[model samples]
Target: MDPQDGYDWQPQQTGYVPPQHRPRAQVPRVDAGRLWAGGAMTALVAALTAVVGLLLIRGVLGIPVFAPEGDGAMGDASTGVLAMGAAFAALVATALLHLLMLATPQPGTFFVWIVTLATAVMVLLPFTTSAPLDARIGSAALYLVIGIAIGSLLSAAGRSATRQDF
Candidate 1:
């Protein structure tokens, strides 16, 4: 038999063995409980802010809380509306965080971009709609405040909730 035929293809038994491939770092798992808690807190705060701001604008500043079409007053932007909107925003935000955590390597970074863009869209709604100038400004301010509160809180919550220990 030839010498080459008897040789094996296994790695050589040299004392200085080359290093094996290093496993990739583990991705952190997101804690949904903490995230949802933040969402709940944000929803409460945003809803409160909306109601208080609406009162200040309409009650204090004498700005009627009217529809975007410059129609009659909006019945004080009722608590039901504000609470439901805030809760809905929070839910949507939480869902988005869950998606990013599962599918994206950089969930926090993407989360910020997503929240910011959505807030910007919200901020622009009054201007594009048929709302009056004063009403538009007031509504836009409320939207800005609510968006900032929700976005910042949720993003922070998402960042803090992720861990490698899973």
Candidate 2:
């Protein structure tokens, strides 16, 4: 019998073993109660921001915004509309942030980008109107302040609502 064909032959074994794959990163969980609470706070802040901004522009500075100069400090019904609009915007932003948190990997980053772009649009929108330059500028400034308040406050709310999964 040939030695190569002999059944007594034993196979060589190596002690080295392949490493196991590392565990995947965990996704974050969102707390709806906390998020909505924070959103409500943000909405209140945004409404106040609109009211105060309008007062500062129309009442203190005596610049006509969202109405004629004859409309006085409060600038007519437009001021109320602006306040309601701001509150509504804040609620919409909250919904967007909530959706982003649930669907995206980097929710905060995306939220900031989205809000920033929306703010830019709002700030630029007044300039397109046929109103006087001062009115346009004042309105734009008011929109800017409102946008900032909403974006910053909602961002904080989103952060507070996120919980990291182990």
Candidate 3:
């Protein structure tokens, strides 16, 4: 006690004090069913995007893509192949997103980067082929559209499927 100020005073105690207990943060949970369902829809959209892009390029624009001009607007079997490939690619991306969500801190950001780089590769792939310049451009544009579709759709799905634990 300080008699002059009429106030109680205490000296600081120094020792090895134990830390206070803290509650651990909960881990975010993911709904696999919802994620997979979104993935399926994304795949369907990707496939359709591929088909429509091909139709627009080949039928409406009269540009040969994935086949010769003599193959007509449908572009032979390659059209179906491209559509299927897009769908498969969507499924694969969805799976990757799922894995990232489970394992990474910012899954969506990583997924976007991965998908964007992959899409860039696909878009540039046509330039490496023996196809004409116009065909390469058209194919590149189509691939870009498909990649955008898949990336966007899957991102939305991932967001919807994630649940924050309080």
* Residue pairs whose backbone atoms clash in candidate 2: none
Residues 94-160, model 3: lDDT tens digits? 9999999999999999999999999999999999988888899999999999999999999999999
Q: Give one digit per residue, the lDDT tens place, for model 2 in 44-156.
A: 99999999998899899999888888998887889889899999999999999999999997899999999999999998998998989998999899989999999999899
lDDT (CA) per prediction: 0.75, 0.88, 0.91
Ranking by lDDT: 3, 2, 1
Sorted on TM-score, best first, the list reads: 3, 2, 1
TM-score per candidate, chains pooled = 0.77, 0.84, 0.85
TM-score of 1: 0.77
Write model 1 residue lDDT over 24-132, tens digit each, in one string.
5677888889888887887888777777777677766666554333322334346458757976897789889888988997888998888888888988888997766
**Which ranges of candidate 3 are over 4 A from the true structure?**
1-24
Q: Determine which window of 10 residues in candidate 2 has minimal summed lDDT.
A: 13-22
Model 2: how far is 105 from its true place, Å? Answer: 1.4
Model 2 scores what on Cα lDDT? 0.88
